[model samples]
Target chain A: MKNNSLPTDVEPAKTDPRIKLITAKIKKENYKPDALIEILHTAQNAYGYLPMNVLKFITKALHLPPSRVYSTVTFYHFFSLKSKGEHTCLVCTGTACYVKGAQLILNEIEKQFSLKPGQVSADNKLGVSVARCIGACGLAPAVVLDEEVHAKVSSEEIVNSINAKIAV
Target chain B: MPKISVTIDDKKLDVDVGKTILEVCKENGIEILTMCHLKGLTDVGACRLCLVEIEGVNKLLSACTTKIAANMIIRTKTEKIKRYQRITSELFFAERNHVCSVCVANGKCDLQKLGYKTEMNHIRYPYLFPECNVDTSHPWYVLDHNRCIMCTRCVRACGEVEGAHNWNVMNRGYQVRIISDFDTPWGESVTCTSCGKCVHACPTGAIWPKAIVQGQLEKKPEIIGELVEKRKMNL
Candidate 1:
């Protein structure tokens, strides 16, 4: 593939020294091909979801096509294309979990939060999604609160769990 | 050639410098289980099964792609490595529509063998019964999307090895999938070489010859290694 020389669609960073510092550090690391995912993670941690500037800066630094970068960003689920809330709740809807009533639990969560799957609650405290099995089937009907798994749960149990998290 | 001394599974061996731990282990008959790694392809390191602890490296590095250094200490079968491998294999089983008994690749699938080898009797994770379409559109092959592991070996083989650029991954994360170019159906994709390379490259029964659907769903051809090598030369 030819190296892309065209200007990128992602916006350039604002004149913040912190941004400059981060970019400088990334540049110094030399952005090896294998480090692409890690770089995206670091970029998101620093700039929240990959905004135009971060994407453009990454493109310019890596000398990669902007579309190629964007496609990669879209390929991996770990990379978020949009901003996330303070807390995200992922309900496992994999077969084992589903057989154990994962959907019912998810419905209860959505009802209590007044939102649908993959939506952020009105209060912005929780973001909900129905995930594929997260490899915790031993704990079927598992709900991931942030990154922690609460296993072998029921709809009522999930409601209580969310209420507890919200209270804290 | 420079030599690097590394300890794996407590056995000390000196290996030629610059080879990945995987190449060394394979050459030395030290088995560290892995999938998503076909020799000589770009190591995407998607499967975390080959992770091993390297002294001074905090995170586990993939043996398939990480180059060896002089005097490196590595542990391949530590409790942590075993646990992670089991978890990743369990996840693989849970995420896809792997009903082995009904599937054509039941006896010959690598995932099935891995499950047996890992002693995973039951899926601890929930099963994902994602709705899938089985495409028997191609004249010579059947594309069963449901059985796909999404390793993209076929896509890589088609694009990088075959020079057809016919296959590409579409979507992200769990939703990520292999697609023929232009969102066209497998039967309709214009770029496909009809070389049957992707079908043969598949690890599961996701792609197989159409005529042999019932009795002919066979293990991937062992010739894939040579095919990959030949394609590299041609490319």
Candidate 2:
């Protein structure tokens, strides 16, 4: 993937394919300023996060004010300004989940990776985060690695699942 | 636009159909507390302060964004509204490190006035104590995230009024921050006109001129509205 429209500030290799995908998405939207959210979603797909240069590129390409774009990005829970790790881990902290030892699981993940919520591991292998609720109360405590839901995850099973999945 | 008759807090008044409930209330001298609202900018409804009860609506709606409809019964001073207002004010204080005792906008802050208006004695919720940044990179201004409630008035004012969209938000939830030109230092921004519109747009001491000290910031937010009004005249 190559983005001919990619901004110069970013490196050529890591940003190229994503910028190409993002550019395609922008073209698909016809570069409408009001389509900021949709474009950001596509950018996340391409780049894993909304990089500063990419955001700047989008603001210019869409002809929207930079502040407006920024405000919208930060206001939404789904948006992220940083890159996700090769493996993404999400722990639900809903009332049900919390009571079922979600906190312990979260703590273990942090301990295992030495990374906090919203932080990627130094090795770039794991990204740790917490969700308010995943609507999986039956699972009590759940961990989502990538799109696959690990329901009813016990505190003891947390580390093993993350390590096994990442190893695969 | 057609005039719609509506009852706001038992007072019947005919207002413009397309105008928002907050605008109607403002025209009729009904004070609805707000923080994210700036007369000159677009309303994002981020702040829930102007929430009012209306007949037939089960949930309270923010007055700043909802348009006035015919025969709508709006209650601005309901017990529910008052309770929520207090909770909202408390949440604003609890969500950040808003230590007003030593703040620059101690006396002039709208958030403080909102606290007083809501009669918020002390916060029941635990303080978030989020480690926030104080950006002094700008030569003339300081961006103190400690006092920020994320009202986004500065974001709107910078974009809609000054036409300099330098200020934007970064992150999510209580971790959100107002970033200048894609999370760069304010002094290093290429788009910042250094207009200081954000300083006036802020309801709290999160943004202030660098030269100002504790309890000394005197912001005139009305000037933004005045400027907008003047622009309409096309001078």
Candidate 3:
């Protein structure tokens, strides 16, 4: 396909075994037009993020409009259009977490790995993002790695955990 | 269809069935404030300016999309409704960089009139100050994302009325944007007809002709309904 300079990242997504799994999922849904949301979830699972090519492929495969697919991905916070590294790190920036020095943790992680909010590290080992009040106000400053939430996290603890993931 | 009696601001009237509260309000000479409720387009209930308090319903419902129920005791103007209207208008202003003083729509903007009707002297919320784009790729018009309120009127106008399907929304709350043709420049659109329907569809100065400048914009959104009405005539 001829490239049209899409807004997403330049690095093309790899054609791995995940495409077959995604195809099977789409087939399982019988290509229902209303199954867009569920198909998008499957696409995200197949690709770490909903890359532009993956979105286009799904649009054609399911016979859905491109705008419908694009708008849905953009409307939901959980769906990402950009690449997320192998390991994801999220810092709670909710009012409660901010007062508890969540900024320090974000800053420390950024400085240590040279990562910014919503960016996958060049090494593709870690990605940094911020959350607003993850409902862990009691924990004050909380950090989420992959799926587990760490409460009352300090600057040093965040740096070490990221390093531990990076080391892997 | 059955006609039912309803009271709007203490005035008793018999309204037809299947019509929305907004349509009935308009028919009865009652004024209801609106921004995203353009004619000839499907209502997505994007703007909350026309929220009316019903006697039975606990929550304020949007008048544009909600069908009038039988015996509906509708209140278009109340102390609480006015307060919410003022706040919603203020939030619309503060959500983006709406520099009315230097805008192309200037005094001719609907958003400005909404502010005046709500008596909004100042916005209580802090300005979002999002870094929006100015897409002047089209030869005639420009899409200024800064002044956009995400009402989706342009998106509907182009797709539903114009049959272009060029303008599409991208992203979620607060960070959402109206993109033209796969998020590319508008000038490069493969589907746009350059009809300027989206320009007329916009409530603010978000979409306008490049031939005009500040305070020079003149739009007639009412023409959308007129066009739809004329098409139905088949004369």
In model 2, what is the error at residue B134, expressed in angstroms?
0.6
lDDT of all predictions, in order shown?
0.75, 0.85, 0.85
- What are the per-residue Cα lDDT tens digits for candidate 1 across B1-235? 9777889888999899878899899999999897788754567777888999998989999988899888889898888988888888899887778788887777778888888878787778888877777777778877777888877778777766667766776676677666664334677765787988777678888887765644567655445678767866898
RMSD of 1: 12.1
- Per-model TM-score versus the true fold: 0.60, 0.76, 0.82
Q: Per-residue lDDT of B114-221 in model 2, one digit per residue for the tens? A: 999999998999988988879999999999999988888988888889988888877676677888875667888888999999999898999899887876678989
Best by TM-score: 3
Candidate 1 regions exceeding 4 Å error are A1-168, B228-235
Between candidates 1 and 2, the one scoring higher on TM-score is 2
Chain B TM-score of candidate 3 stands at: 0.97
Give the winner by TM-score: 2 or 3.
3
Q: Per-candidate DockQ versus the true complex? A: 0.08, 0.35, 0.28
Using DockQ as the measure, the top candidate is: 2
Model 1 Cα shift for residue A72 (angstroms): 6.0
Candidate order by DockQ, highest to lowest?
Answer: 2, 3, 1
* Alpha-carbon runs more than 4 Å astray in model 3: A1-16, A89-119, A129-168, B214-216, B230-235
